[model samples]
Target: MKIITLTFFSALAISVCSLIGPTSRAATGIGDECNKGGDVKFAIREYDNKLVSVCRADGVGDCLYTKAFGKTFVDNRLHLNSDRLHDYVIKDLSGSYGDNDVTHFMLFAQCRDGNFVKVGDDFFTNLRPDAMDRTTGWLKLRVTRDCYNDSISDTQERSYTIVFDPKKRRYGPPDSNPKLTHYCSDAELALPVGSANSSR
Candidate 1:
């Protein structure tokens, strides 16, 4: 049983690392990576690994080293603490977009351009939280002028925050650590969907 679990985690780690790479850099915007300007932050992490900053293309972007709370993004449902990574925080997460309540959540990205031509897709779509029950949470509405620009001009500087009920799973508990994002999240996090949102 121990060997099996270890092998499974190892495999998962290798796979995630491949997808995100040793490091993640936003493209000119979000094409291959992202193009971040001043005041914004970014990060990426593999399963069971700590969140490490790749580098900063812009700003007081200090470097960081820590693990974020959750992994996996899918259908407006994010499973928090599923990893039992119970020592991270999410307040002041870029643009004041985080709170201690940001344990595990989802963001729905849509291109309001009336055409799905450039941007459209569900951000997180993998894994089930072994730490607890799985449920849907958060709903977001957005549009992109240039789906690859780090700096976005919000023709509609508005976004929606939704909480989806598991109905079957009950909302996952909110386990937090106000020290998560502060220490190193502004640069990188295991599952930050900001890049996912900004791309589209």
Candidate 2:
């Protein structure tokens, strides 16, 4: 019985050692760790100071996202009549949304010039770009619909004016012209970024 116990212990040690390999034994079987699973969502809201279009971009809030816990069930989401991507690029384009508890994100972009490319990893966070010009990079942006171990929140509604620098070939907020002090300010839930009656 003593010999048998010794052999059993040795076999257990060998089994653990075998799992340390690179590819084949990364982790498998009942004792292995599982990857966190969840979905990611992003919503974009844009508007002037009137607070008409400052609705929930995500089911909870505006055009925003995160790499962690997502929005709650108590969200006052935006009610949309269509899922169609309208005016893929708009000036004063800023919004917010929740992360839904996930890690790892990639943003894909499609320009009006038909140039499609991915924005790589984790480039957006508490991000409120001042403006968007179709001629520039903000024509279209995409987010990971699925995620792993992440969290996020939303952006408010305000006037976000974007302009394109033809020579610089870039987009940015102006120093003072139509200064977007409250680009996404005073945003409430369950409102749409269009007409007041349109917001739910």
TM-score for each of the candidates: 0.18, 0.18
Poorly placed runs, candidate 2 (over 4 Å):
1-114, 117-157, 174-200
Listed per candidate, the RMSD to the true structure in angstroms reads 19.8, 20.8
Residue 138 alpha-carbon offset, candidate 2, angstroms: 11
Residue range 26-97, candidate 2, lDDT tens digits: 212111211112112233332333121212223564433321223211111211101111222211212232
TM-score of 2: 0.18
Provide backbone clash counts, one per model.
16, 30
- Best lDDT among the predictions, by candidate number: 2
Cα deviation of 118, candidate 1, in Å: 19
**Model 2, CA-based lDDT:** 0.27
Candidate no. 1 TM-score: 0.18
